[model samples]
Target: MHATLTAPSARRTRDRATLVCGIAGLASCMIVIMADFTTATIYERLGLFADTISAMAAGRGAMIMDTALLILVGGIVAIAFGLWRQRLPGWRWRAVIIALLAVAGIIAAIALFNEYGDGDVNDSWTFHYRLVYALGIIFTAVPLLAAHDLKPIDRRLWLGSYALGAAWFVAGPLMFTVPTGWDGLLERVAAGIMLLWLIGASIFLIRQPDGR
Candidate 1:
């Protein structure tokens, strides 16, 4: 009887953890949006549509944006751990978890080594731009890898992930081709796609029947 009781208790604990992580994932999305807009207001020359988030972190509101990014890292890490506890089958699922952690690390690095201000050009020596490039690759890879695994859990999420990945493949390259003033807009669109997947995946994890 004690063993059986412990099993249910453990399951409940996992459920609660997944639930908290899901909420954290959602909260992280809100924090980034708020930080971007708040910091944009601090700079007279900053144009939200024309200025990339890196510009916000590199300029007048560096402290605010950097601090928010650190907080965002914690939230993403939580979501990664939440998924890790699920013990999903196959290498694809494992790859998804690894990608999520990599993304969190990249975000933290970006905050640490922010890019040049909006008007400045970043050379090859800048690790910030290199990290951004790496992030774009791995971030998009997560949804594509996880899409197959998510099929058994939720068909809609699986389809959404596949579609999101496909869209990123096209849009990611377009970001660089866009005019100077438009790159920022495209950057945000790319980020929004990733965040949407993160939010949706977290919700599905929270709703899992067994909370595994």
Candidate 2:
């Protein structure tokens, strides 16, 4: 006979996994950033900009970059699955979870199909890679928006998600107007904001009591 599924236990496990993966992913990114000893300032070089690193030949930080990205993508996929396992209240909630999963999938794709090498921006893979990255950023906020419905008590969390989304939207266009040196800085800010939102949401999910 098949064993009966325990909803509460399953939910706790999922929540814990989500929290752990979220933190792990962020930590991996930080490690990658620190390992990069390039002369370019953080502001001058976009945070984790694939083109600046990940080259097979000249990539100063390729090993750490690839390792961190693999870890980050794996963690993201785990977190997305964890969120999906939860018993969302309605179809709308389910759709949100699916969207989050899609975002994670896209990230995984980017990690798998990375830039050819440093200064490989003109390549077709690099072009698609950049496009997917932008799309991922745009959709990152959907889970946060759906979180508003999941956890009504935490008005601040959902509001923060909306704010991040708006900021990302505005920042994308504004980056072009800013000095070229600041492009990396702007991209980092947008990415950092999204990561913060994920961290907050993961914490909230962790603290929720069973059956929530």
Candidate 3:
């Protein structure tokens, strides 16, 4: 009886940890959806610079604004989780990185929208894209690698997903460069791909454990 009770107690603790992570992940996913919606609209305004999201501004801005609010609220919730739960150092860093990258991605998307297909890439725009992509990639992957705080299966998922992510970012300089025409679809596409990838990884990181 004592052994059975101990097992249940331990299981409950793990379940709680997993639950918090899942809640956080779900919150973060909502933020990404908001950001992506805005991006699609802005890209539309930019003339389908991406596969979708071509020529949407007011709508996109509204979405981005909503996303920002969601992110802020999510952060508050996350902070409460961290404070109340025994989060691992790895999990803490993961949360921090996720926050930073999401913010940077939003800023980059907005900057691109403002550029509005000037037909000329400015130094600042160029710099922001490079920095945003690189940092986003690194942050998204590193935390996955360090995510030992999670269960063994979660750690494995992090390893596989992040490895591909890391490889993608490392090749950014070569794969993503300035476009030569009125439509730099490739560059925009790459950026979109990175955002979605990070979003997916973040979701995985945030998910609550099952059967814990």
Candidate 4:
């Protein structure tokens, strides 16, 4: 009877791992989305409050740069752990890094048009908000999309989150005709969805066996 119980427990453990991996993958995407939106909020400050904050940020641009780098690393780690735990060896660190560099480059290029680039101090720094957002989006989307062993629940959560990626992509060029604030609204929607997905995944996984 004890041996029979142990056999069932071990199988249950394996099943739990699948759930955890799925949760990790979902969390990774959500984290990237949240971080990206955060950087965008800081970037889109055309109001007095934004100007004040940007002024302060510009004064210590290097600090902001360092902070962005730290987040970049943290994002990478989260993504790697999610992939490893979930048995996705292919879309691991290499994917995260390549996506990061590409997205960062795009945002940095866009930052040149902003007011911050007026001085040498700003030029010395490399924390382009757009680049970060792009990186966040790509990294989050790629991992979940490519996660090989996704359970049905994982697919349900991620498929919904993937729509935001499309929404942001479509909204990007549309900003030229509409208002800049329009992008902010879309980002807020994306942020909310990402948060909800992460929370939901957490609740689903918390009760499952940790060994799984």
What TM-score goes with each of the models? 0.90, 0.68, 0.48, 0.44
Q: Flag the better candidate by lDDT, 3 or 4.
A: 3
Among these predicted structures, which one has the highest lDDT? 1
lDDT of 4 by residue, 53-126 (tens): 23323443434533443443443343344434444445443464355345444434433333454555564325
Q: For residues 1-212, what per-residue lDDT tens digits would candidate 2 score against the true structure?
A: 23456776776676666566555555645554454434233332543443333232124445555566566556555555555655567776666666666666665555566665335555755665575556556465575556567456566766776777677677656655666545556656655665665555555555543434
Of models 1 and 4, which has the larger lDDT? 1
What is the model-wide C-alpha lDDT for candidate 2? Answer: 0.56
RMSD of each: 2.6, 5.2, 6.9, 7.6
**TM-score (C-alpha, index-matched) for candidate 3:** 0.48
Off by over 4 Å in 1: 44-46, 117-125, 209-212
RMSD of 3: 6.9
Candidate 3 residue-wise lDDT, 12-38, digit = tens: 776676466545645665665566555
Record all residue pairs in model 4 with backbone atoms less than 3 Å apart, i.e. clashing.
16-212, 17-212, 107-131
Q: Per-model C-alpha lDDT, please?
A: 0.82, 0.56, 0.49, 0.46
Q: Cα deviation of 43 in candidate 1 (Å)?
A: 2.4
Ranking by TM-score: 1, 2, 3, 4
